[model samples]
Target: MSTVDLGDVDRFTVAALGPVGQRTFLLQCRSEQTVLTLKVEKQQVAVLAEYLGRLLRDLPRPGHLPEDLEVEEPVEPHWVVGTMGVSYDAELDRIVLIAEELVPEDEEGDAARFTVTREQAAAFAVRATRLVEAGRPPCPLCGGPIDPSGHACPRTNGHRPPTN
Candidate 1:
């Protein structure tokens, strides 16, 4: 399998497109001349943010996080992400993010590896959390999204209509 090593990324962030109920999440990163975008699920973004937040807590606080954390235009994803992992490099004081492309079990998929500064990591975590929270509100009883059309909450056994 081929792997794209985007060493020392300059920009990294997660973004969502479209409305709350019908949105597409993307994990985008850039290192100098190269830019990579990957399709990701909302749950993945949420979990990644949570994981990074926890990891950052154990490390020293970052100073002067990046502010222009917006998704670059023409968000053409290279591939749909299957699995992702992150780790810290103590010597370099950076965070490494690894993402593998989704593929059938019998086939091999490409992978991407990148490293970002602690400041970039912190910015990404905060921005990703905000992007995930911008989605449709979850149902109180079932914790499922309350779609604008309607949500047949399984908790109530379809007995009541959605309130929001």
Candidate 2:
């Protein structure tokens, strides 16, 4: 297996291309000289954002905080992520992302590991929260997403369709 270690990254963010309902989500990390993009599921992005927010909230403040954070879409993805792991690195004061690449049975898989600062983690969490909330509104009755066309609310028993 191969590994892409981007130690002390400059930027990291989750982004989606296209509309919320029909979007392709990505986890992107970059340094001054390198950029790495990985395909990820929307649900994974949402969960990571939520969990990262909670994690950062519980940790002590770092010595330095980023003034601003930016999210940029890469030209192409290096690999699609099959699984991912996130953790805090106290020694480096960074948030680590370990993304395992998806590969065929005969081929060896690669892992992309990167570290972003605490400030970047906070920014990522905020952006992720916004991205998740930007999706279609939830049905009041069934709690399912209310699509632009319509929604079949379980509570209605097929009698009436929920309005967008």
Candidate 3:
């Protein structure tokens, strides 16, 4: 719903991660045990709240937590997103979504930013050239099988782009 659903977060703190020029928030879910992450657009908050209330109203009474809109309780078992299963926590009086945090791990060489040296770049080029020469087909850019072609390109009226 919201970029960061508040349920599992602590103390009203929402973690916002960056792609620099874009406005986005990484919603984090943490228990005493684990943490999960998700990124979403900011405008979805109101819609998320409406759905949460609709989802939680099934509880007999006071299942909704006024102080924290993130937590929830349901009167019966239900499927979230029509798939992931979660239901009300009557004792806790909060609606809880049972899902593993959609967290992604960082791979080597990827970060906020980095500089590539000429020597390293040249070495990469040589290796790439050799790999390509070993027996790969012509670049789909020039000519090759349709599925193997990278683009959803088609000739129009028997007029193709100039071929290699």
What ranking emerges by lDDT with the best candidate at the front?
1, 2, 3
* Residue pairs clashing, model 3: 72-94, 72-95, 73-94, 73-95, 74-88
On lDDT, the leading prediction is 1
Give lDDT: candidate 2, residue 135.
87
Q: Could you give candidate 2's per-residue lDDT for residues 80-162 as a string of tens digits? A: 88888999887777788899988887888989888887788887887878888888888988888888888888899877888
Model 1 lDDT on a 0 to 1 scale: 0.92
Off by over 4 Å in 3: 1-21, 43-45, 60-86, 89-94, 99-164
Ranking by TM-score: 1, 2, 3
What would the TM-scores of all predictions be?
0.96, 0.83, 0.30
Which pairs of residues collide in candidate 2?
none
List the global CA lDDT of all models. Answer: 0.92, 0.81, 0.32
Candidate 3 lowest-lDDT run of ten: 107-116
RMSD in Å for all candidates: 1.0, 2.6, 20.7
Q: Which residue segments of model 2 deviate by more than 4 Å?
A: 62-73, 103-108, 140-143, 154-157
